[model samples]
Target: MDRIRDLASKKAAVIFTKSSCCMCYSIKQLFYELGASPAVHELDKEARGREMELALRGLGCSPTVPAVFIGGVYVGSATDIISLHVDGSLKQMLINAKAIWF
Candidate 1:
């Protein structure tokens, strides 16, 4: 949990993901398209991957692979992110976080 917090806070935008997860790939692509260079932690490629996955689950990420953090705060999973995008709020959030200037 502490590790997750540390990593999440180190970047303006952070995404916890697994390499093989399609939703993870989509979320990453969306952030890139929005011009936010998000910090992507591929849990499956980490030494402490399992531990981090469990920690993410504890933080309310049900599917967990596409957990997102913006401005050092837990934003939610891919579904939540998509909702924010659809509502035209995701871009604003990135701007506020300084992940994207425009």
Candidate 2:
């Protein structure tokens, strides 16, 4: 409860993924390159994995691997993430998520 809420409230981004998920690997690589240690929740083994899946689905995203959330906002799938990066919005998103900018 509190732990989950705390995790959801962190300034850093959160990426919920399952093992052997290629998109998850890609997103992790990209975020690591950007010097951000995004919190990773492995849905496949998480206690409330199914609840998280339902939540993502309710937010209009697929209940699949690599569901991303930034600053408590759902950011959709891998394609959406890559699109954000390609369009040069990822950094701004990080800044906004962290509430810090240089």
Candidate 3:
């Protein structure tokens, strides 16, 4: 969990994901489209992957891949991402976090 938090607080945005998850891919693409270079952690490829995922669950993230964080805060699961996007707050959120300049 400490490692995860360190990674999160390292940048404006972070995504803990699984490499093969389409949702993870979509999330990465979304940030790319918005010109934000988020730190992406493909947990499935990490040595402590399962441990990290479990730690995330303890942090209130969904029991799934694609856990997202902005400004060093845990945002939510995939649904929350879509909701933010639909509500038109995703862009502003990124901007406020210094994840995007334009």
Most TM-score-accurate candidate: 1
lDDT of 1 by residue, 14-33 (tens): 99999999999999999999
By TM-score, the better pick of 1 and 3 is 1
What lDDT does candidate 3 reach at residue 47?
94
Candidate 3 lDDT trough over 10 residues, lowest sum: 56-65
Q: Candidate 3 on 1-102: residue-level lDDT in tens?
A: 898899889999999999989989998898899899999999999999999999998898885579989999998878898899889999999999999996
lDDT of each: 0.96, 0.77, 0.91
Rank by lDDT (best first): 1, 3, 2
- Candidate 3 positional error at 20, Å: 1.0
Location of the lowest summed lDDT over 10 successive residues in candidate 1: 56-65
- Candidate number of the best lDDT: 1
Residue 6, candidate 1: alpha-carbon lDDT:
99
